[model samples]
Target: MNVCGLDRWLRILVGIILVGLAAAGAIGVWGWIGLIPLLTGLFRWCPLYAIFGFQTCGLAEQKYGS
Candidate 1:
């Protein structure tokens, strides 16, 4: 939830592209790693962000348990 809308969307898009490429055999198995970003984006929780004490969620959202 700490992820901003745009950032989350971008991660989702990139993850989908990478995973799709992997599934299509267009890329190496490494592309499957895209799941990381995909899950993070969908969950709106980033470990790195937490470590860095960063948050992109709106004030209201954050206050409401984002």
Candidate 2:
């Protein structure tokens, strides 16, 4: 749950737009990269974030009872 709130929503939105463009043959294969953000947003976890020790979800600890 490192990804949360607005950041998560933006990732989902951008991912959808990019993938949609790819499917429509508008952005070509590059748009396929959008799947990265889409999956991260869906899972609420980002590998890069983990490596960088970054977290956007403030409620993560409380939610998990940590």
State every prediction's TM-score relative to the real structure: 0.86, 0.89
Candidate 1 segments exceeding 4 Å error:
64-66
**In model 1, how many backbone clashes occur?**
1
**Candidate 1 lDDT, 1-66, residue by residue in tens:** 678678888889999999999999999999999998898899999999999999778888777854
Q: How does each model score on lDDT?
A: 0.88, 0.88
- Lowest lDDT sum, 10 consecutive residues, model 2, at 57-66
lDDT of 2 at 47: 97
Which 10 residues in a row give candidate 1 its minimum summed lDDT?
A: 57-66
The TM-score between candidate 2 and the true structure equals 0.89
Give the winner by TM-score: 2
**lDDT per residue, candidate 2, 12-64, as tens digits?**
99999999999999989999999999999888899999999998888754397
